[model samples]
Every structure is written in structure tokens, then in C-alpha cells.
Target: MDTITHTLFGLTLYGTVDKKEMDKNHKRAYLVTAVGASLIPDIDVISRLWDTAGQYQMWHRGITHSIFVTPLWAALLFLICAVLFKTKDKRLFFLGWLAVVIHDTSDLFNAWGTGYLEPFSNDRITFGTIPIIDLVFWTIMGIAFVLSKKNKKKSPYYFKMAWILMSLHLIIQSIQGFLIYNQYDGKYDQVALSADFVPWTYSVIVKQDDTVTIFQDNLFQEEKERYVLVSDKGADLDYLFSRRPEAKTLYEWSPFVVVVDDGKRLGLYDPRFYREGQSFLYEYIER
Candidate 1:
């Protein structure tokens, strides 16, 4: 999920709690606990400043988003909030834990997935079920925000309802993606999915040998062919890897990549993100 969605999740978590009798300081502590935990996993972004190995792509959503790290983050937040607000309310810890878990889990649904298992397994777990910036989530939460304004006394229930609807949306989207992926799995050497901004739509990339085909797809309809890419099969990549280490990382990170060798440059690009005449994920070195 994007920053805005994560922040909204935090606010929803905070609103789910009944703060009616609490003083301002404790309320502020709970607010911080919810929002802070919601975004803490993204702190791994700082590794970019010292990314000498050209591993930023892999490191960005790496171990910091791990389930193993969630409890530790919650414990630290608990200590900080307790001292800062002078309140021993244990609810802060639970809220922080839930928020952290939500943040970590949500990223798994996007094409640019996270290393949720991290130290245990470095696999990039992606279902490609939901768009990174899902308008459905924004709309659902927006409705709850509006309804809560109309019924102030029942605001908590409204936000909780938003959570329920959001979970249902995830379930529906994942099931659709799962079926689409399986439909293509047997027909291709490798398959990858990138969810469309519009719900229930996807860009499905299927690779068979050096040929890569991208289709604008939906579960209920036939896939429309968008682009066909051919990879430079059996190309020597040692020189390219030495010239651009990031190229090596991209090759390893993607489920399948199109190797480009047109007698001028050596490169690798993930076909999943191909658009127009180029790909945003292409990494190359000029001869």
C-alpha cells in the first residue's frame, strides 16, 4: 500500500478505540502508537543513502517488514508511549502490534511485494491482487469518515465497518488474482501478474522460452494481448553484471526478465512493468 493508505489505516485503528473518557495526553499517545506502527516498517528506506551494493530494490521491502520485527517494534513503541504520556495503558502495545502487522501484511497484495518472511525466507511474496494505490480502499474509508461525521457517537463503529469492508475487498481481489494466475501457470514457462489500477483487472505476463507476452486481463473475460517481448536468449551477462551491479540485482529480483542485447547495450528488464517503448525497471550498460 502507499503512504496515504497506511496513514488511513493508522487513523482507522486509532478511531476504533474508545477515547471518550481519556485525557488529551493519553489520547495523543494512542494516536501516535497507531500511526507510528503503521509506517515504521518503511524506515528501511534509509538504507538507500548507503546502498553501495546497488541492492536498494531488494532492501527497501526487506527484513524490516518481517513478522519477526513487528513485536520488537511494538515493544519499543510501548516503552516510548508509556514514558512520554506517563500512562501504563497496555492497550497501546496491542494497538501498535496490530498496526504493524497490518502494514506488513498489506504490502503482500501489491506487485512490488515485501519480504514478509525476511530472515527466514528472502522470497518476495506478491499476490498482485490489489493496486498499490487502491481507490476502493480510499472510497470505503471515505464513506466511513462521512458517516461518522453524521453520527459522532457511533464513529468507532463506522471505522470498524470500514475495516470489515476493506478485508472483504482484499479477499475478493485475491481470489480473483489466484484464479487468473493458475489459469496461465500451465501454459507458460513462467508467469507474473501486475494488478491494474482498476479493480478486477490485471496485466498478466507469461514467459515461454525467450518470448514474453503481456495481456490486459480480467477473470471474467478473455485476455487482450498488449505487448510481446523477446529476450536475448543465452546472452553472456557476466560483463553486464560487472558494469552495472544493479542489473544483476534486477535479474535476480524479478520472477522473469527480458535480457536485452541489441549489439549496442547489455541490459535486463522485468517484463511486468514494460510500457510504451521502454520499461521503468530496465537496467542497462552501453557498449
Candidate 2:
């Protein structure tokens, strides 16, 4: 999910808590923690881009996307916030950790998936449920935020109701995704599916064809050249690579690999490249 959804979630949770506890400072702290925690899942992109350039880099939502980082990140941030704000509310600490957990919960809907335990295990987990971005959800939250801001009445009731609605929508979409997956037949059938959480869209590449279809709200969008999808049904990374292509210079990685072909020049291609005067056969190697 994008920051806005997390922001709204943070705001709503904090607003509701404040209404009950009558602690404005704690509420503000909660809101801040919520928004900050939401971004924790994406820290992998930073680590990958800056720390490890290429060579099977972990990006976006990986180990950092797991439940393990929740407490650590929340505790670290909570300590910083506590020092800065100088408050002593146990409730605030709980709120911070809850917000971080909620942030990871938001990503479970998408197809791109996340590795809840990367450092522990490289296995990727995905329900193939929702798209990262659902316009309907965005609009609902946008309207709710705007209305809540415009209105002078600071009622937690409305915020709570909005949160319930959003959560319900996702739950319903997840049921639909399960149905779609069960109905899936032969290879490439019912491959793409989307599950979303506002601005963030998670696309599942169940089976890759000439085009990778990402289902969202019952529609498919072909990934032209984003990622190379591979089946992880069985076999190790090396075994999967062996089955794909027989290129000498080809590189192998889990779910995907870099295949160097003897083209007019050295280039990248994984059933998605479209260029002038390119041969699929003369293609030198596959991973």
C-alpha cells in the first residue's frame, strides 16, 4: 500500500485512541508512528539499490516486509519518538508496534508478494489476493479524509467505521482471489490476479506467458518489461534455470535469471523484449 492509506490508517487509529484516552500528544505520536512504520516494508529497495547493485539484489518488499521487523522497527522508532516527545504512555508504544504490523498486513493483499522471513528463509509468500492500488479504495479514503478534515467534530466513530469498511473490502477481495485461484486449470490459465491496498498494487504472476497479466478488480494488465516470472512449484533455483534456457553466459536466480544471448550485441531479454531484427532462435543462452 501507498503512504496515504497508511497515513489515513494511522490517523484513524490515533484519532480513535485519542478520543478514548483524551491524550492529544499520544494521538499525534501514534499517527506519526503509523505513517513511518508503513514505509518500513519498502526499505529493501533502498538496501538493494544502494547496498547491493545487481547480482540477485533484494528489492522493494522482501525480508524487511516480514512480521519480524515490526517490533524491532517500531521499538526503535518509538524510542526515538519518546526521546523527542518526552512522553510516557505505554499505549503509545503499543500503537507504534500495531501500526507497523498493520503496514505489513496492507501488503498481503498484493500479488507482487513479500518475504515475511527473508533473512530466515528466502521463500516468498503471497496469497495472490489484491492489487497494490485500487482506485475505489483510494477514492473512499480520499473522501473520508477530506470529509473528516473539513468537519469540526472530531468523532472517532466515523474514523472507525471507515477503517472497518476498508478492511471489509479487502477481505471480500481476498475471497474472490481464492475462488479465482481454485478455478485455475491448465498452465497460463487464470494466471494474473491483483490485490490492492490503495496506492500500492501487488500483482501475482502465477504463470508467465508472452505477456504477464496482472489481475486487479477483475481486469488484467500485461507486464511488458517489468519482471521475469518463473514457476516455483518445485525444484531449486539452479534446477529451474536449467529447465528455462541453455545459455553459457546465462545467470540464474530464484524465480528469474539473466540470460545473455549472442545477439547483434549483448542485451537483456526474457520473453518480453521487442526490438528490430531480433531472432528468438539465434538467441544465444537462457537461464
Per-prediction tally of clashes: 0, 18
Per-residue C-alpha lDDT of model 1 across residues 1-287, encoded as one tens digit per residue: 99999999999888888889999999999999999999999999899999999999899889999988999999888998988888788989999999999999999998887899989999999888898899999999999889988998999999999999999999998889998888899988989998888899988999998999999889789889999999988777998999899999988888889998988888999887788868888899888
Query: Residues 160-199, candidate 2, lDDT per residue (tens digit)?
Result: 6677888887787777667655544356543545443433
| Clashes by residue pair, model 1 | none
RMSD of each: 1.3, 7.5
TM-score, candidate 2, is 0.67
Please give the distance, in angstroms, between residue 280's alpha carbon in candidate 2 and its true position after superposition: 21
Candidate 1 — number of clashing residue pairs? 0
For each candidate in turn, the TM-score is: 0.96, 0.67
